[model samples]
Target: MNVILITACPSGMATTFLGARRLEQAAKRLGWQVSVEMHGELEAVTPVSAEAIAAAELVVVAAERVPEPQRFDGKRLFRAPIHQALPDPDAFLERAAREAATFDAASANAGAPATATPAPQAAGGNGQRRIVAVTACPTGVAHTFMAAEALAQAGKAMGHAIHVETQGSVGAQNALTADDIAAADVVVLACDIEVDDTRFAGKPIYRTSTGAALKQPKQTLETALVDAQVESSGAPQGGSAGAGGGARKSVKERGLYKHLLTGVSFMLPMVVAGGLCIALSFVFGIKAFEQEGTLAAALMQIGGGTAFKLMVPVLAGYIAYSIADRPGIAPGMIGGMLASTLGAGFIGGILAGFLAGYSASAVTRYVKLPASVESLKPILIIPLLASLFTGLVMIYVVGTPVAAILAGLTQFLNNMGSTNAVLLGLLLGAMMCFDMGGPVNKAAYTFGVGLLSTETYMPMAAIMAAGMVPPIAMGIATLLARGKFSQPEREAGKASFVLGLCFITEGAIPFAAKDPLRVIPLAMIGGAVTGALSMWFGIKLMAPHGGLFVLLIPNAVNMALLYLVAIAAGSLVTGVGYALLKRGESELPAVADAGSGAVAREQRTG
Candidate 1:
């Protein structure tokens, strides 16, 4: 088959040529006729002739930004990311040939040129500043999405483009893109689990804990693009705190986690892919409760079975890429398989692969072995160790506890209204208001997700509503009376309202942190009231995270009206009380914002 290929990475960078060169090399090995064109930055070599694109049996585009399929009009186009080809020429040709042959077979039949488009290229692309977040917690549910929601709100409020990639029990949602990284001015990582930031190389990035971002979003904003490399001047290799390691100071170099994180970033879909598919399988296919028909069977075949099967390999493959630089794929795949067998899904598989790679690395480092032993690293040493460790830990420790907790939660929820309904709501709601996005907030979230197993989502929904209102109401009040907050604080209010609507209670952190005395109680009062009310009126929510945005997704929120009311009432009270308590306009910032000063206290005379 005759084939013509064009390669172009996001930056229109060198990878474009590399991909083309790789494909050409592959075709050469197979003794097949092929032509390659290069775009982006080609130093001396020119692209393949346009005539080739016109005459070829198939057109292959290894482009980071896949041009709209419409561009290739009648050409048989097979497009993939430039990464697929570069540095591995032979494999590229083989894959290209396979795709071309498939297209040829199609053309032989009653086929048109070939259907071109793949899933969406980019929807919700143009956000402020293009921030990419990997939100997570060990539990993979409540705290994960809550923190994700908080960070997204924070990003939007800061007027920066943003894309939040959630890493939770429900799996990843809104995966980040290379374009997202390239276009971003800043990266705010509000997470406990590791988030890969290597893609943000050369871009300013603020790595902060979820709690910190939620509680001090404005301060977080300060650290975002402007402060990741905090000092404006030739900043010290490391910041004053020296929080990062030695390798970290060099913006040019990345460490173990950096590489691993790269793969984790890509592996996000596996978690989601597997989980959502399995959920659909159970929902539509299995009919665990009763007999299901073809619809359920079909859903499981597409959603559950295949996607679930692909989970670990994808996770491992990406992580290996992070490590050993290029050659980690084989080891990563083997390790990933091992991880899956241990019941360690996507996130766990990543960890297993990393361990496998490093251990194989150690064997290479210490052992005076021959070249033959080297290949064994991937097929033997790496996979064996990673799989064993992952399996043992998952089954005996990680998986057991998780299963027990989930089981307990499910059982409890099933029994919730059966015994202590009102009391539970009050407790959960109070927790929601307790510290906004702190550990207290997470506890409430976990309870709700846990109850999800029992087919109960009300406790979580109420808690979320209660936790969301106080900050927004306070923001409204402050906006209404600019006299009640400092200049900076007043500006922050703009962000707070947005965060509040999104159910990010931590948006009011500055106010609460600065004036725990008056602000916290008012916020708490509103939050508690909101939560209690929501619980009294049952509300169901589907998406694990996001404030109101989650409301937009299919079957996202049940009893939306009541949920809105609960949040509104709480916000209103909080706003009114906060506005009234604030003293002089000048005093507000000193009282409510951490970055601002204390109210100039009047000196008492002797």
Candidate 2:
């Protein structure tokens, strides 16, 4: 019999191709001619031809999510879980053939794209176990797919049925079904960012990073099989994996920081995009918004009007998401809108997010409902109650106080002439580098960006200058003291300089994560110097962000030459400081540890 198999997963890595090879071998051994197609995130997929589809007697789909499946409308099809086709591929193929169902061409092709009718749950009745996993990374590229492959391979070797869902940059490939989660003995979450994990509510879950899974897949699987927890509906095992290993820190201790960072991470892109667009508008002169039908006006509308407006609501919504997953989005956004209306700025957005997040979480945790209407908790009750609670608090209690403080801060910054401005710049600069993109860094950024609405631009200028120092400084340091950095880090430094010029504070994250104690203090000192010089020179920037690149726009920065001088001075100081201070050989691993859990190792090195 002629057979065709498609192996597709997010990240389209080893998980897809490796499984395809195994499945092809299994089919060949079963005396059937088989062809396989591989779909991966990074690699180009070889499309299965229409001729191949038409000639096939049977098609087996072993994937977490198949992007398009309508082609097999008239064929006998089998939807097998990922793990089924790996180790004992012969058995899996035989079983799939026995269970394959013929599709009605007209009926299947009539409506929405034909979807795979999931096969009945594997009973694990043949002395095999069942497992399900979700693998993800911040970039959702290599590690995410590799981890899925590792787990699948290990599980197959152990004669266990495994299905891995990959969350990659392109999107989720093989999405887990409710039945898969239900029948699984355990759920493995090998990810570096927050996932929609609430789906695994009552399931036994084993949590770790993608790196951990790649390194020790067998251990991860073995541990999951034995020590997984039946998670609560309220919070996932570790409160949203904050930056680095900091997630392990108690919510009571770093919860505010973690949740705030989550909001900041989501909010920053809007700030950067809006800020640059607004800066671009300045090319048509400062009052470009007043002009109609001009590129300047368009930029203003996009930068100042749309993205800026959405920034606060998005911030609040994601913060709530971090706290209470998807259920918190609506309430948090509403709360943020109220905060903006009340003139509360970023602070208000933050408050609204936390309030909405906690309130939504509380509803999910405490507001028990009948099993018949339990679905209403996430859909109706949590959002409704959280929105109400957050809205009320933001409008009444939080808004007034926060607005007053923001107003005071804005007034104070406005009144500063030279010395006061310099001091403030120094503090803001120090804060920017102290934690690289952490709470303190974002706090200063938020304050500076918050003042854009009030037409106060110097603080933002100072903040940006300070923020740029860390990455540029580290990059310069790497060039000057190559021996202090590993080969890969030196390459990273070249990239850091470019990112630094673009005002991406995250470029310094790797250096800071490697040796916070040595790197951070030096960064802070340099940033402070840059910030103070920008303010003392009375230099003002009209744009909220965008480093050197924004200077290309006319009138974006008031003293472009002086601004460059300040950045150079700061970079030199930081580079010289590192050259003088950093002791011993570079401890940077040959392979950069990109995992969030790597922070614990950084702590040890420090």
Candidate 3:
């Protein structure tokens, strides 16, 4: 028999390839010819050719989501969660062969091309609702696709005609068209990050997180149907388009956090470029750049003089944009530039961004104009008035006090004693591991990044070191106590190790989500240890991001050997702790089941 297997995951880091390998081994044992296609965050690896797909007797998809399902239209298809395949591939394959059904393109409209018409509702009569949704997460990986798949499955089972557009790291797939939006009875946005809802104006919209959608998809759908409200055509109620007209009060706070993160995301590239350039200049001796008309001076000019100068403005501008859309950009950037010139730094820039965004949104909503001149509101009137207001406030009110505060803070950090430094590091480290990549982690990261503007590098070093500990520790724990983790988790640990080396904290999320009680505390202890060590050793990092690879660049990190030791020590602590604490998979079934359910609930609440 000829079999075509497709596998995918959010980041394309681990599960996709692992599932393919297991399925291939199982297929080979059964003496079947198999072709595998793996989809990750970017693109497909060794995608199945049309000829190969045509010749296959069965197409099995083990993924959080199937990328471009239309490619296999009319084929006999079998779908299962990627985890199901990892535990027992032989049994999974047998079920695929026995239960695969002919896939009709029209039945699963979510993955249909833009031009495709809506699928007919399931056998139930007129009670079926037409729903459209978009799912996204901060990393644009795991939760994004999981939520999309869950909603699709739930909608199908409940006799609803639903289509989901996934906004993953690779960009939007199966995007919603004008026709789809117009026809939908309600729209659901399952996102942890801000998304453009301009096109969704006038539609009944509901906002939620990916975790909530994944855990209680049926309930989420019901809630949306009942509580979703029609979005207004004007500026959003609380400076966020995603916060629809009838959104709950808590949404306003969530919107603020998302807007701040949006700014940080835009500012990161500039920080990395500028920091690396400064580091490169230090290679010629710390004072080399002081001598003008040289390569070191030129590098410093590009990195410090230009990129660093623009970072605050870009951050403030994007934050405003996330809150009030395009009109807020000019005011926010202008305010940010003023903050920089006045020495108020990143803190002032953040304040300026919020002020500008809310002012712009308020102006847009309240200002009235004739029909002929209404177009001028977004293009001319809004920018001019908002910029004036934001600029005046920054210069006359906010800037001087903020500058003084920043100066004092910088002085304190520069002269801090070792004990104080270690305490600061420990606090930052614990915060980083508290929620993986959630708001607390981002808050710690944003604090470190902000300090870069003040020429303080120690905190940045501590933050990165602490952040790297979790995934690396998880990987080590799996190795030390292999019997504690399931097959899927062991494979995930291997991927987590690689991701940790790259400083992606989300790598340990799978382990944490499954066993937070044991994993989180152990990881936090390791992070704290690494952070304290980094501070005590007086290690300094010039770059804001990059993991172990930062050590390769000359002068990128000071006290590099000690830095590595700090990271290794932390990983060892967490690894050994978790390995001893974790329960073996062979433990009593009832206990395991209860533990699993509790962990699932915790993940959902979080």
Candidate 4:
């Protein structure tokens, strides 16, 4: 019988991939024809097809995130917990096979959709129904999109038409449309913050935390819609709507960097704006050497002060936006502007924005309401509350450390020299491999950019060279020594080239995270050696983002030939050592780690 399985997790990188591998082994052992797909970044393999789903006698979902609730409308489904799939793969396979022996395809087809209110829920094939949803988190970083993708991808794996919207640091992506909303049998809002528009007013609405969507989208979505039906059918109920009440769910304890991610997401635009404005002023405005005239000075000042001023508000506003949605827009902008005026710049602006938003949210949540309260959310409540918080933070919190850090970082860069440059290189390179794009990586990167002002460009070159080595070497070694890594990892070699040039050190993280003993130390030694060598050789580069590709760009690097040597040395060590220690399917189960889904996914498509 044809079978399709969906694999997903919070990160969709390692756990999902690992799960897919487990499922594959399970399917192979049973001699079952199975197809698998992921709910993550890489394009899906053997994506679920209508014919495939129709032909399947059973559908197995190995996931953390749930797809749309209706995908399994008329199918025999058994969801294997990702944990079970990852560790005791053989046991889960046996369990699923035993359960599949009991599928009642005929009865499922005869029933109405698993869930859906009669009034607004649209009917699907053989009385199946579909739910459409949007998932978001405060930082717009990990959970927000993972929730959405898991639902959509999982739903599809279950044979449902699922569309997703992601509220990420880049803003709303995969945006849901009016058509999408209208066609949905039901709408689910899985988020931490307030999403815009109450357009699904008459639709059977389901509101849940992102975790609910990830782990139990189908159950939750079904309850939400069916509960609405019970309510509409005159079932006596509490005054609240759906499973919740007028009060919003406060999502606490998400991750260490969630709030900070929101602040940074909000702050980036301000930097872009201010940086561009200042850069432009440096370009077209009066040069200090060209003119001493007052009008020339005025033009320069306006460019620097005017367009640049908008930066803070946008930064703060977006950070607030990331957290509270539309409500965050006003206070965030105002607080950001206040921060700039108070001499805080972007850092202060971010603090002011977050403070304004959280306080404004608290004020909005409590402080008893009158009939005018609805209007006050926009007209009065937000501004009054945001302004007070912004004012306080700017005067005290935002102004102090924000100002000092900015000053200190700038001073550090300005004074970097030939003697210190080599040390700086080692630091940046090591950081690049430590966590890839994490906070440590950011600090090192930010420092490199900081050095641009001081005209000390070598640290960036070392960073660039070091960053590219791990992924590239890891990729080459896998290709050169296929027997050392698992079948799943060998497949990942397909994407490693692109990651290598882009300098995404985390490309190697899946292997490293899972097999740190064999992988990390070797990779680190390689990285450290490369970083030190690049600096000692005085390889210099501009541009903080690009990797070896930058050398091809005109005049991007100094001592370009030596840069290649430095990169090659690191890459070789990382590649050879990683291959030697890489794990096979048997080895994977031995490593117990957090975020099981990520490990699974990385095994398949890392």
Candidate 5:
């Protein structure tokens, strides 16, 4: 069989490539000729030639939105959402082969391409709702597109007209127009970072995290339908109002963790860029940057002097922005600058952000003005009052104590013995793997990142090392005991390995979701082992991200070979342990076996 596979996602990051790889692997296993075209945030990678498309027996589109569907007119087409192909690509392929229909450009409306235009009402029309959604994450990589796809799939399944705007690393795609927003019955913001919601005024809005939307799309939508509150025209952009005219707090609004995570997310790019530049400066020798008027010195100035200088301010500003929207930014940034000047560091910056955010929010809420003067609240009144309050409090009340604490903490960490270092590594490692990419993982990550501004590198090294273990270990486990996993799991393990190498811990999510009891403990154990070993070896990392890839930059990682060994040691422990303990499909009871009949059938057919 000749198969032309088309895979795409909103971000064209992890999911796009994962789906393409899975399907290609499945096709190869079935002894079929496969040509893959992948669409992502960037240009399509090695698109299938027209000759190949013409000769293909089947066109399988595993995408959020099929681009240029007219190209497949008159061909047999099998279209499924990317989510469907992710976990069970082999089964997905088998189903495609069996159920593919001839594509007619005119009749199918060119694969019903995703557009700002609203989808036609479902047949029988009753209970239909028009939904507009925006999905964003701090990294703007994996979760953003995943949540968008999940919501799109769920909305389709529930007979709702839905349009999703993805705010990712590449910025917003499939953006919602004013008409789209106006037509929507409700707006869903599945974002880990703060998103501007002013455009959604007068519409019912429901907010959720990308994880929730990805895990339980239908339930999220159902909840949104029931609990979504109307955005009051008179209220501030980020604030919300219920039907009864009372303020409604969302997950982002109520949780200090979310606000902190938002800050961390916004701060990450700065850390990575600054850290890498500093690493690069070291390539010219550690003392090279001390000599001015050179590239190395310039790199240092850019990385350490500018980027690092702004890092705390960006973190603080965004944290406040997450809390109180635009009104909180000025005060937050001013407070962060004060924190840096006072030598209070990231901890002080965090305090400043919260204080400014709450102060601004309080002012926005309580300091009502006449209609003629209301325009001045956010710009003039809020910033002036909030900044004054935050700056004064930070300098007078909080600065000295926080600076002392940070200095003590830094001194202790810098002088800690191997035993203490190992203990700290173990704790951070466990936290990194605990929930993969959830709050616990982000907490550990944020801690490590915070230390970077203080020139403390070992904790960051351990955090990353621990984070890389779970996915790589899962990959190793599948290789060690293939029979213990399904075909999809095996395929996913290959991708997981690659993702792990790049330090994407979320690659282990599918494995963990399937068997958390086994996967999570094993991963945590592996992470702890890696973290301990890295610390024991006295490894130091300059960059906060890029996993093993960062090692390519000279001096980015000290003791690189030992770091690899530490990672390998942890991966081996997890892989070997899980392989030994995991149960094979054949070991399942009758009930489980019955439940797996469809997979068995698909395997036989393949």
Candidate 6:
């Protein structure tokens, strides 16, 4: 059979090429004529000609993401994930051959599209259940779509109605409607990144990692539906939910975490803009803003006067938005402003956000209005009532204590600066690398972000530096100890270098996930060194993020030269440590699939 095969991945990196190579070998062994086309991170390579497609009897698509499937409308088609195709290409090719032979080419050419593999359909059951789900991952790539596809197939097999919304690099696709959401018996959130789930309030939510969905999709869906049943009936069906489920409480806390992270994610851009601008102002001199009509003064005005001043309010408003959607924004902003005015700082902003959000939600839920004026509740009543309550509580109850707490925090930071810089740096740095972007890493990051408003920037500098260390160190280690890592890992290391410089500590997750014992300790050591040096040099960073780019601003860091030196020193330490500690490839596991499903290692090879 004449076949045209296409391989695509998020980064168009190693997976695409490896999948192509695997398929080619299989096709050759099977005595089939096949041409492969690669679609990758930046662009297409060795693209198949239109003539090739027209002449081919079959088309095979191997991708985590299928781009423009309709292009092969009339051809017999077979599809699988690009990663899985690498491990066993011969099986896919054999299946493709059988499918192509059975498919009707004449009917396909006449008008109807040829579908070799029928989609999964749910078996008839007691009752048809409708499900709505969202799948997301940190990199917005592979795992997002993989999980969605898995869940859809699982739902089909169980004979349930399912619609999956994919939030990926291409953005949200097949988005769920309000009516659809309302109708669903349960909402499945398969994600590693924090997703806004306020819309699913009053509906039972089931939380699972993207990996879980990929690995055990049917079980994941079954658990969700069963939990919903338990919640609705107030009794466990078959005792499964009763035995292993605190599902409701878990879901509730997951929703809360999502809200907070949403706020932090939204607040980051403002911090970057304001901090960078303020840093730029120092280029013309420390007090350049005092002198009018200069570029530096304008930058200072825009960055410090406007952006910085708005940061806390923006953070709080978004947090409330995550909780109560649009209705809570006004009260949240007002509360944040009050917190700033009262010198309660970022901690106050967080409290204001939660207060405003919960108050707005309560008002929306409890306040009854005439049907004729029900629309007015969102526009007029909720905002008015929530605002008043939040404002009064902030002024009367929360303002003074929070301000005093903030003052105490500031004093503690000052003390650390003089007496415990190294210890503080070591602790923060280790925390940053400990779980990558998990709770520990976030705690360190949040602490640093909070300190920005207080002008205690040394901690922020140390945190950023330490966070950058793991990925860069891993990249350097790969280079220094070539025999210690597999071919695929080395490819991933190249991508890690860029990610490290961008302050994405999650870049090291692949290496650490594969061999945490060897990788994590070395990473922590490197991170600690970077953090200690940053503290020792008294490096101050206005921005909570930006990595090396932040160093470009003259006044952003107190000691730019030393900061670079520290990063280099840390990277070297980690690289040498890995070289000394890790045995040759004979002792290490093969790195064929080292990364979590979400990370875009494909970008590295392509």
* Model 1 TM-score (2 dp): 0.46
C-alpha displacement of 400 in model 1, angstroms? 5.9
Model 6, clash count? 6
Candidate maximizing TM-score: 5
lDDT of 1 by residue, 410-502 (tens): 566555662365566667777776666565666576455434323466776777777777679768877777875678988788888988777
Best by lDDT: 5
Predictions in order: lDDT: 0.57, 0.73, 0.80, 0.61, 0.82, 0.73
Model 6 per-residue lDDT at 374: 73
Estimated TM-score per prediction? 0.46, 0.59, 0.70, 0.55, 0.74, 0.64
Candidate 5: give the clashing pairs: 12-40
Residue pairs in steric clash, candidate 2? 11-41, 12-40, 12-41, 64-174, 64-175, 65-173, 65-174, 65-175
- The sequence of per-residue lDDT tens digits that candidate 5 reaches over residues 136-180 is 877777778877997999999998999999998788999999999
Span of 10 residues, lowest total lDDT, candidate 3? 114-123
**Candidate closer to the true structure by TM-score (higher is better), 1 or 6:** 6
Model 3 lDDT tens row, 110-227 = 5433223222222233598889999987556556887799899999998899999998777899899999988888889988776777677767778877766765588778657755
Writing each residue's lDDT as its tens digit, candidate 6 over 1-606 gives: 788778887533446656777887788788777767766422224345667677788888787533445466667777677776777889888876666443344444444222221111122235678899999864454557767997999999988899999987567899999999878877898876556564665666677766567545787787576444212323232221111122332434445666666667667678778888888889888887898899989998898788877878887887887677678899999998999899988888889988998898778766777778776877889889989998899999999999999999898886665448888888898888776666567778888987888878899988999988888988888898888678998998988878889888867766764555567778888888888888888888877777898877777887889989888888788878876776676643444333311111222221
Candidate 2 TM-score, C-alpha based = 0.59
Residue 252 of model 3, lDDT score: 38
* Per-residue C-alpha lDDT of model 4 across residues 324-440, encoded as one tens digit per residue: 545667877888777767666666765766776676665555645565455555557666777777777677666767767766765665466766766766676777776544455
In candidate 5, stretches whose alpha carbon ends up further than 4 angstroms from where it belongs are: 1-129, 157-161, 231-253, 370-372, 593-606
